[model samples]
Target chain A: MKQYKHHTLSVLVENKAGVLSRIAGLFARRGFNIYSLAVAPTDDQKFSQITIVVDVQSAPLEQITKQLFKLINVVKISELDPATSCEYELILAKINAPGNNRASIIELVQLFGGKIVDIGISQLTVMLADSPTKVDDFEALLEPYGIIEVQRTGRVALAKQETSSAKLRSISGKVS
Target chain B: MELTGAQALIKSLEAQGVEVIFGIPGGAILPVYDPLIDSPLRHILVRHEQGAGHMAEGYAHVSGRPGVAMVTSGPAATNIVTALADAYMDSIPMVCITGQVALGSIGTDAFQEADTTGITMSVTKHNWLVTSAQDIPRIIKEAFHVATTGRPGPVLVDIPKDVSNQLMQWYWPDEVDMPGYKPTVKGHPKMIKQAAKLILEAKKPVIYAGGGIIRAGASDQLKTLAELISSPVATTLMGRGCFPDEHELAMGMPGMHGTYTAVTAIQKADLLIALGVRFDDRVTGKISSFAPNAKVIHVDIDPAELGKVRHPEVPIVGDVGYVLTELIKEIKNLEKKQDQSDKSAWLKQIKDWQIRFPLTYDKEQTKVIKPQFVVETLSANTPEDTIVVSGVGQHQMFATQYWKFNRPNQWVNSGGLGTMGFAIPAAIGAKVANPSAMVWAIDGDGCFQMTAQELVTASSEKIPIKVAILNNAYLGMVRQWQEMFYEERYSEVYLSPDLPDYVKWAEAMGCVGFRVESPDEVAIVIEKANAINDRPVVIDFRTDSSEKVYPMVPSGASNDDIVVDPSQGQGGM
Candidate 1:
């Protein structure tokens, strides 16, 4: 029996047109389900960073990683372990806060370190940037407020500190 | 020195040692063709853009070099998509250059415009859309580099007309600076040792060779290792010529339609050393039950293929040639010989299976020439070094089964994609690559008709390749499938013999044509066709339509359930 687990991978690829679709197409073709994917330009203008969260069975991890490397634009891949990585997701929700409900929704937003970003006559839009689990908790707490619309920026992650070790180590101690 | 992008492109191709290019000229590509007229590289104009692509593949199949094809934008680029996909599936190294709309009008639906890069992205190993004329030299170099390196496949470079026509300084890059495109070619020493240990310790080990062996030119290393370990070798269709079929240890092609001995040996093996082969679904019928008892040592250049199908016990990612060379050296150093008593018993069991279920067909009873008989006769008459090509269908299977491939690159076919019209164009390419070698395209009636127009290109180019069409009056393979699985409904598989008159078609194409209906005439007609060295010849062997490819493990069925003869009650276990 293989256990299905969520894996966060950071990929550095050539900043070129159609590179994103190439990566997405690979994931789709290989049947790897993406839980969340985020892409943004890196410090280097020549390269872009893509953070992809995939829900896959244990057996396909090696294959998935290798397949990612097969893409010509993909330069590097770093699997971010949950234990040593900082991961965050941002969500914005619009609640139908009719007067009485507005105060309580605002109170809950403050309790979760969220902000009341926009205010309308009958609705208040709340924004929260936090770990995925906290965002889930905040969404669940505000479910009773009759949320009208919601949007989420998928998870983005980075290692807390760069490990000064080679990405691939030689078994025979001879530099490849 | 300053030069036009088209001139630089031609110079770069010359730098890459390209002898010839198969293609047709059109509007957007005219600038490139203009420079080509003065270039030393010979251009063979093809009937269709698709033929050009397949011709390149056929050339690559024999030459072990990246084949080149060029086409104009839009429909020409789109027409070659099948060949690109076929090359991708079979891992053939090919470079395709497509002329695109000018950079200014790229997205505006300009005349003779298509998103060649976008359309070919998923189908190619990699592709580039050049926006600048200065990038031509580097991109061409990169295109060839990527196409020929690590798990080789087709790469496309789409050049806008403006880019090709624009003036640019000509200088070949000192190095390809693709930081992302490095391939691991050498196996880890420790893993190689581990693989050797496994080989020596195993009682019933099978060397399962695939196309990687041929692509890497590792057939000699593979043969040496197999012989050293005294293991019986079973080749996948892609790996048909990687191992000599006449060798004592050779168990011909394994999987669906595989020889009984070969398929059974894989099923009953205790250890499987898979070299350069991905265990595709067609080869591994039911994944869970495939080589259930065996520990697999999967060796390939592509790491993704390691655990994509069955999880290999020892996964070594490297070039097949390099890995096998190191592995053989490691085994030699270890100086460990297999336990002779147990090894001989395993060999004896395999010998029994080979003798008991040899590939057989009723040649005597059928009045009509059997397709297998045609292939067998063709095999016997051709030179030992003959390069045989085929399109996808019953004739492809018959050619793969009957033809004796004594050397690597002697057999070429669309093994992975199984493209229907691969024969004529690929044969032309092979003949172009090796003008001295005899090349034969063994095709089915259905497959031959799909791309037979390329025969005209062959005639014009003076590529004297011989074609043997197994002219069964039906789409034989599909009809066989419909017979067994679809209750003999036979749907739309019939192809009438008298309709097109293949003989007249060949004569019209400026080639000698012959039709052999009787088994007695099969050899005589093949000899006559073989004698024509001045121009292409097409021999139509009208064959028995009722004959089916046997030893078929119906799609998704276990190897244990292989149906050898549908006429017999529930083909043997």
Candidate 2:
């Protein structure tokens, strides 16, 4: 059996209505799988950045990027490498806590640089923002405590801004 | 100029040089139709939206320009989806504008409300949902640009009814502002040189051409390339007329229903110089074994198509004509003249195959007329410049196999999608495009029933296209499959020949009707149908249903195991 590899792609598109639908429709019709997707407006008002993690077992990365480029609103697709890019995800969770376990949970949160947003009679709402792996570790650690609810925002990534040296081959998919 | 969006729409169409629009007006699209009455552009009202869409497709197939279609919301928009899909599959240039409900009433389930954009997003190359009246002209420009460029597929623009009613200050932009839609029209010089080297070095080369040759107006360039290289050309079904069948080096259409020489030559080739073809499944039976020893040099305008089916040793992405020009130049510069004797063995092999297994049908059946006979007789009687259109099924295969097409755009059929109801309206549209040329539609009993009502439109419009319905009394292709694979337990495939008297139906549609039961009357009625220049004519030629397309590579089978007529026993092989 062939292993299906997962790749994260950062795409810049003209910010407008139904652009997401167009991208989603392309994926669906082409039978490409979406592992995770994050969409947010860029610093510029006219363009938006979409970070998509795809798991298409049958298609290659070049094919996916080529199909995306066919869409009129899609401007650029950048393949974000985990080795050089900064990838982050946010997780919000409420853990069932008694008064005695509250201090230990707070200590764990402080150690991980997370913040306790609210304290309830029997629960504590914790907010953690970090790399996807770290967020997963945090979720695993909090599973010991009775969990009330959990929410996670899909990953958003950007390439590292480095001026030290430029490499001959960049990580961007196909073309800008 | 200050104008309503509907008025500006007409003006934009006029600016775009769209001479005709095929559509049917309803509540949502009433505003767009209102402006058409005053505009100089002609509008042919169709009975169904599907007919309008197919008519545009046929018009585009013949004229090499983007055909235009407009329809109302909901069912009308949905009805046109088949044509959109068909055009998309064949990469026909078409612009379809569907009217939507008011902006505010959208998603409220108002009357005739449908998510037209969402429904058509997958089928269309690009589509726009216009919210403001000011964006109409720009979107229309972009729609035409997108539909007629790159691979040339259908595009749709869904406008709200209120947006059409609103007034706007209209100014046609000089250039479209689509940053992401720049299509590469020129091949890389280095790649062209590499391809030229491959062409010169190959011992056995086959030029497999597709509809892209006609779309890019590259038939002349392809012919030059084929003749200069001494490579035999095998055209796909959509590429029927690109290479003249009379040319000695021309191999006929290749695939399931292709000629024997074409199928055998491709299998034995050492190199395939594929241009503007996607290597469709029908063409490549069992992809793994298709052209087993061939190193491919694939060129197409669409990048995704280059490696979608068959990966190429030299993948060149550019317009077909431009690539052919560059390739021809590079080949000429690389070598002053191609050594003709280098490929003598390959050429001789193709010639031998052509002589051994010519496309043949039993012509002595006196009780029943073979469908191929009807097609051949029609081919013999029609003018050289006549545009041949066909519906899907066994009739389509026979139409393409028998017709001797020598010029580009002289053959039109639903190649990719195999839309059943395509022939009637498409013939109407083709005749409209080439008013001086005689257009003939060869149809089947099953397919003609799908869009027969469009004859009414053709008759009323005075576009005289003669049609011959091969009354096989069944879905001929499906029945053949059932007989071969499913023990001949024919399921709902039969449509009795005499159920709907086609002559009466033709007469009711204001067309001159003729019924020919025997083969003796075939040529006489065809001559009569040809002479009628004032209105559309229909002739019902009741044909035998048992006759099937020959030289068939059975489903999922390798091209190596192609079967000839079963009656001609397998003992020879």
Candidate 3:
């Protein structure tokens, strides 16, 4: 179980009122630590997709998915593997960038595929949407410029397409 | 037919085969009650919403059907939360309908308005807050479906006052289409075979049966499997009557207050066939050290239960009844016959422990009536099919300890949540479920006082559920814990026995009441309580408060270190 570290789960649920509450409530009641969650309606308006990343340190992955499956609104649960899953987080940071350090910060932002969303005389509001690891690196690189304020969105994820079709079922617990 | 949502709700309930409902009506739900006057559903008005919820639970526990409860918005819904939690914990099938404020006033904090769906999200298995009158029939259908199927639990449906009054074309859904909620009712063939192989090969195997056997109606299969394999069956507190206490392979109950033989059998077992049981802390003292030598074969309708506690070598996610049937078939196909001599050594060891530390109390010398003796006499006097309901406490343990249950669903108690006031109302519901069967509620003084007012409802309804109050006048279980762990520093445990004057209180509720003290009066009072059929009866038996439940595992200690009765010697064994 230690080797299976990616705890992100892609859950498809009926787009109904209180669906999110039900899923969130289950975690609270069972004491499962969910570190990140993102919800959005699917193309089929009646359904919604919720990407949840639980703290593996607190709860087992099997228990989390099994409990989620018990929810009547939940349609499907796919535990996204880090190696075969595409995951990304969006971070918006207001970084101090005076004339002296402006060019360097701009260059660094470009290196990380980030864009300066807003520009002021002494600060630049930059936004980056990339893998969590890349987002972390970009934040670190812009730290010297003295970040004024920063906001980070919970991660949203999907399994990689044409990844040589691996069995998504976890071998950790005996399912049969 | 065009009908109000309230009318559709009542009509849908009737369509669902809901014969009776235990509930209380209030402002938000006034419109619903109007339609109820003409509906075929017989509504039992309860003193409190919690009573209604528990009565529904009691009904479901005995009938294997979803117990239906309805309450108004705000505090009324909040009041029934305990019962829903109790039902959720024990997996009782229950459908609770709550009336919400008018749709426009929902978030505005109108009078009696509550976020019932939000509040009950954690407690209930599933819930619906109706956004339209059109969705009433479909949602009600889904509510009952979710509540009754796939590891049954309490589900709530909150309809606003306006929706109940709004007119809509009444149409019942022909089928339930919740694709995500398919419960695996049959075990995998391979897993069943593996479980059979394990059971057949193990020298010492113990069936750790739980309430699932009763819920799944699998006791017949359980008996067949236990007999075929010659394995001992240890029923959990929730699994009280799943296996007959009188059976040769029966290990009684296994847990904190479990019998010496039952607790020790699991500790010494090589294989544990845990059916519908979650290795709860009370049952498995220290999870790290519980059943250390045993390889587990877990079966339950809820897959999450498998590998949630003690990991099983063969985790079969299916209904216990279906799994037992398959395992029995697999065992028969794989093995020729089970030789009784194969498990003779294990049986002999269990018998030795049973003889050395059988449950005993000193009634020969005690001047006052012993609570255990009262239960024994009550069990002896009552009909064999009598349904015994108990509240949580020492009396709860005593009732199950003394009662010899030979069939399933004969005993009802709050096992998971340990709700104190469960017995009286639950017994009423049980009586309603089986009107001809004798229903007795054995309650502690502390527990009885919590829901004694429900006796009024029983009297008015003519439920005729007999109740025995073991009046120790103290919170006996708490006192025992304080004496053992808190150095006898009693803190607010004592309740004056004579203060409420329960006999007079019972009379106030329009029921026959009696108070007994001497041991000689026990049998006579029990017989008198048994004879009452016109209305409910209450007997206040003054019991010794100092008595404690024995064979305690001492909270988180290994089952190997069980503390037997002090009188048994060997340092309380």
Off by over 4 Å in 1: A1-4, A57-59, A161-176, B336-341, B565-571
Residues B512-563 of candidate 2 have per-residue lDDT tens digits of: 9999888888899999999999999999999988988997889998887788
Over the stretch B506-547, how does candidate 3's per-residue lDDT look in tens digits?
Answer: 999999999999899999988888888999999999998889
Q: Per-residue lDDT tens digits of candidate 1, residues B295-344?
A: 99999998888878898888898999999999988888876454432588
Please state the error at residue B423 of candidate 1 in Å.
0.4
DockQ, each predicted model: 0.50, 0.52, 0.74
TM-score of each: 0.96, 0.97, 0.97
Backbone clash pairs in model 1 (N, Cα, C under 3 Å; residues 3+ apart or in different chains), count: 0
Best by DockQ: 3
Q: Which residue runs of candidate 2 sit more than 4 Å off their true CA positions?
A: A1-4, A162-164, A167-176, B336-341, B567-573
User: lDDT of model 2 at residue B293?
Assistant: 92
Q: Between the candidate structures 2 and 3, which one is better when assessed by DockQ?
A: 3
True-structure RMSD, every candidate: 2.7, 2.2, 2.0
- Model 2's CAPRI class? medium
